[model samples]
Target: MSRIGKHPVPVPQGVQVQLAGQTLTAKGPKGELKLTIVEDLDVTLADGKITVKPRQVTRRARSMWGMQRTLVNNLVKGVKDGYSEELEINGVGLRAAMQGKNLQLNMGFSHEVIYPIPAGIEIKVEKPTSIKISGADKQLVGKVAADIRSVKPPEPYKGKGIKYASETILRKEGKKK
Candidate 1:
């Protein structure tokens, strides 16, 4: 049995959740999101709560039950409050800025790297070293952040590169002469 799947997801006020066949749609003040549930699970919405259950007593159904439930929950929360991730740039001469609508990054590269902002996603640069990525779709927000971070992932030696604000890099001892 999946612990998370057993719990019902409560729908908050100002949010609407709908289920049609294997598809689920959630609309809220922030935005709207849709997801196609796996066939092994069944989802129903009633009394402002969404419940997910396995369609059969098989291993496959049980395996997908909890994951499907979480997907639905994420859709609801994403439409209602959205998701965000923060990135921090480290190293000398490493910084970020907005060039019109695109993100301009200077991470010790000979050429400045420019990333075009995607639709429905917002990027805000507070300080040159800090960046905030937000969007209603949790997956997209996280993907964009990962794309940006991949440009110059933090090196273990000096911890110099782009990294998540909450991430901690382990330091390795350098060569002993």
Candidate 2:
């Protein structure tokens, strides 16, 4: 038995959830999101709660039980409160700015890196060195943050690069003279 699958996902106020065949759609103040459940699982919404159960006693069905339940929970929370990711530039000249609908990054390269912002995602540069990315989709927000960080990942020696606001760098000692 899956521990997480047994618990039902509660529908918060101001959020509407609808189940149609294999697709589950959630709409709230933030936005609306949809998820397609696997055929091996059964999903139901009742009494302001969503429940997930396996249709058969199979290995794959059992393995996906908890994951599908968590996915449903994420959908509910995402539509209600949304998600966000923060990045910080550590280098001296490194900075970020919003150019029209794209993110312009200056990370010590010869040319500025232009990252086109996707639809439904918002990127803000309150400060030159700090970036805040927000959206209703948690996976997309995280993916965009990671993609931006990959452009200039922090180095171990100087730790000069883009990193998550909550991340820690493990600095390395310089060579002896």
Candidate 3:
């Protein structure tokens, strides 16, 4: 059996959780999220607690079971408190600004790099080098962050690029001949 999958997910107050057929829905103050459960997985809901079980105790089944449980847990947490990621630009003429719901980035490009923020996600650009992205869905927040980082990943040479607030970019010595 899966250790994490066997545990119970405690539901907080002011939140509603429902398990219908192959779908699991969670509603909270932030927003609502619905997930379709896969086969061979059993989900139990009652009295503010959710539990996950697998049809078989095989290794693969156990892995899936834990992942499913984590997904459900994220859904519940996201709809309640939500999630966010912050990115900082480090380079000359590299800055971010908000154009309505889209991000305008001038990362050494001749033209601005326009990026549209997806639904359920919010992007904010402060004065110079900070960009804040928030959402009620974890996956969406991560995707948006990844897209932004891809524009200009931190280089080991000068560490001049965009990177997560919590990320560390190691620097390499300049070539001297």
Candidate 4:
């Protein structure tokens, strides 16, 4: 038995969880999130808890068991408290700002980069070099943050560009004369 698959997800107060067909939906104060269960796994909701079990004792079924359980867990957590990612901009003139619903990034590029915010996602520029991305969907929030970070990935030489708030850049030695 998979460790994570056997663990039951507990539904918190003010949160509702429902299973219709293969789709699981969670509604809460933050927002609503839904996830489709993959084949070879069974998901059941009972008494304010969700449990996952493999349909068969096979390699594929075992592999997907833990993954499916985690997906369900994420849905519950997302609807309950939501998710957020923060990015830090480095460099002399590098900065981030919100222009309407889009994000304007000045990362030493010849032209400013404009990143359009997706639905259900919020982007806030708290400071000139700090950016916060929040959303109910964990995957979507992470993807958006990765896309933004890819725009100006930190370089090893100068260690300048966009990086996660908790990320550490390895500084490279400069060339000797």
Candidate 3 ranges with C-alpha deviation above 4 Å: none
- Evaluation by lDDT, superior candidate among 2 and 3: 2
Model 3 residue 90 lDDT score = 95
Give the number of colliding residue pairs in candidate 4. Answer: 0
lDDT of 2 by residue, 1-177 (tens): 999999999999999999999999999998999999999999999999999999998999999999999999988999999999999999889999999999999999999999999988989999999999999888899999999999999999999999999999999999999
> Best-fitting candidate, measured by TM-score?
2
Q: Give the total clashing residue pairs for model 2.
A: 0
lDDT by residue (tens digit), candidate 1, 1-177: 999999999999989888889999899988888899888888888889999999899999998888888888888888889999999999999999999999999988899999999998999999999999999998899999999999999999999999999999998999999
Collision count for each candidate, in order: 0, 0, 0, 0
- Count residue pairs with overlapping backbones in model 3: 0
Please give the TM-score that candidate 4 achieves against the real structure: 0.97
Error of 4 at 159 (Å): 1.3
What is the C-alpha local distance difference test score of each model?
0.93, 0.96, 0.89, 0.91
Alpha-carbon RMSD of each model: 1.2, 0.6, 1.2, 0.9
Q: Ranking under lDDT, best-scoring first? A: 2, 1, 4, 3
Candidate 4: lDDT over CA atoms? 0.91
lDDT of 2 at 118: 91
User: What lDDT score is found at residue 27 in candidate 4?
Assistant: 93
Candidate 1 at 135: error in angstroms? 1.2
